[model samples]
Target: MTRIASYCIAASALFLLAPSAALAQEGEATPPPAPEGQAAAAAAPAAAPAQAAPAKAEPKEDLKDKPAPNSIYAEGLGAGLWYSINYERRVIDDLGVRVGFSYISIGATVSAGNSSSSASASLLTFPITASYLGVRSGKHALEVGGGVSVTYATAQASNSFGSSASGSGVGAYGSAMVGYRLHPVDGAGFNFRVGAMALIGPGFNVFGDDPTAFGVLPFGYISLGASF
Candidate 1:
């Protein structure tokens, strides 16, 4: 019975010591499970990428100026043999007024059936008009207009038979015109106009009782002038 007790005690001690020796010889330990809080933090979804800010825009500038409406101009003019001086004033962008004076003189002698007659005629006309600008380009312009005129005229005649007569009168006139104006230097620069005009006046004599010399006259002009 004593031998059996001693053997049992030695067996229990060997079993405990054997486990400790095996652990020491292995030289490694099993890791514990991760904490719940640390695991949740690691598994959270990554933050989304940040968005960029938009850029600001810049403003634009104006390039040019609008002109004032009023302007004035004058020019030398001619149509056929008559020479004239022309004047114009624009009261608004598309509207204007003009005035001009034109003059012509001629002398002639006629002979037949043993008789001779010498005659001379002198004429003066003033044309007044209201115009519209139909075209407006940078430095070029076109216009059309119509108005009335006044004419003062005279004539003299003397035949070889010592017979002579003279006449003089003032008459009403009407006219229409189209003109193209050019500004060579700039918007308000040295300017000129090319135009066609027609004058119609009824028969009224100043020098004699016969009809006046200028009944229906058509003329052209190249005029030089300036404007402001």
Candidate 2:
């Protein structure tokens, strides 16, 4: 009877503990609830890295192969036939226009048989021309052009007897030129040229001398200046 009672008590105790062990194992397998701060952080999206601002673009420089536009030069034996100071402008690519001025004065004395006569004269010349630059290679060029030159003259004469006389006149000559030039190709610099000119005009007496012969006269010239 004692052995049977002990065996029955052991079986009852094991049956009562089995359900509690299973419930404890199930509770350990499930995760605990997160704290409030940790839950909010986990639920939100991650932050992105910061990016720098873009740099500004710079302006580009200009580089062109064209020559300068303005020039001032002195010329000898050109349209003025003596010397002249000239200003020139490039009206377009390979084309130029020029204007110049010159002045001259003369005095003479004649004596015969205790009588003397004095004479004086002055001349002003203006030249205007347009030229075309043809064949060209770095700083060297060929030029051809045509235009007209206008001249004004004044004369005065006096004798020992106090008699005086004065007169003035105007004249024009048609002129043309062909030449070679040494000029700057890009910017402001030295300029030089040599050329031949042909002049045609009517005959007249402007100075108190013989009348000028009418014809085409071939002349030569040289020039020097700065181009800008």
Candidate 3:
């Protein structure tokens, strides 16, 4: 009977010890699994920083693809009752080239030895011009150029005796001008120019009774024009 009691007590103690050993093993395994889950949670924040880096870099790259505004221009020429057309290309800053045409007229009255004579002339002036334009400010500008001015002129004269005289010739001209430019809308503009011009050189008479009489004359012109 004592042996049977000892056996029962020993069995109860072994069963309790076996349960404690199993619980210790379970505790150790649970700690390693918890550490792996925490490591994965920490790595999630690192992935967020990597995503944020690309977001910060994107705007700078996009701005690089954008284009800048154009500072150059092209304009056309228009003037008063005399109609003319021209083109100008902005080469650098405020410098450019100008080429165009103009129709001109002149008149004079002379008295020699008690004889009064009235004379009038008309011409078509073609100018192939090159100019240096200053920096444009507000609505004002200044320009100067030298070029060949070709003119075909016809003159008519009438004396107190009702007699008539007519002659035709060709001439050369040169000029300098100051102007105001107006910008009223996009792709369009206008200019007002006032200048002094000189016309000189000799040409043959296209229509006259005397072909052997060669003449040389020099004159000045006050000119105005507009541009677009």
**What is the clash count for each candidate, in the order shown?**
7, 0, 0
Worst 10 residues of 3 by lDDT: 64-73
lDDT of 1 by residue, 1-228 (tens): 999999999999999999898887665665565799888888897789999888777765322222223344444443322556666666665577777777879999999999999999998978677878647765566867778877788999999999999999987767677888664323455667788877656542333455665466665666666665
Rank candidates by TM-score, best first.
Answer: 2, 1, 3
Estimate, for each residue in 1-228, the C-alpha lDDT of model 3 and write its tens digit.
999999999999999899899999998878654587887887776543435335454434332222111122222222211444444444543455555566668899988887889999887766655555554444454555545656677999999778999999876644333344332112234444444433222332324455434432222222333333
TM-score for each of the candidates:
0.53, 0.68, 0.42
Better of 2 and 3 by lDDT: 2
Residue 17, model 3: Cα distance from true site in angstroms = 2.3
The CA lDDT at 181 in model 2 is 86
Candidate 2: segments with Cα more than 4 A from true spot: 1-64, 204-213
Each prediction's Cα lDDT score?
0.68, 0.86, 0.51
Better of 1 and 2 by TM-score: 2
**222: Cα error in model 3, Å:** 3.4
Candidate 3 TM-score to native: 0.42
- Model 2 TM-score is 0.68
Displacement of the residue 226 alpha carbon in candidate 1, Å = 2.3
Error of 1 at 193 (Å): 1.7
- Rank by lDDT (best first): 2, 1, 3
Candidate 1: regions farther than 4 A off: 1-81, 110-116, 183-188, 198-219
The CA lDDT at 111 in model 1 is 97
Candidate 3 achieves a global lDDT of 0.51
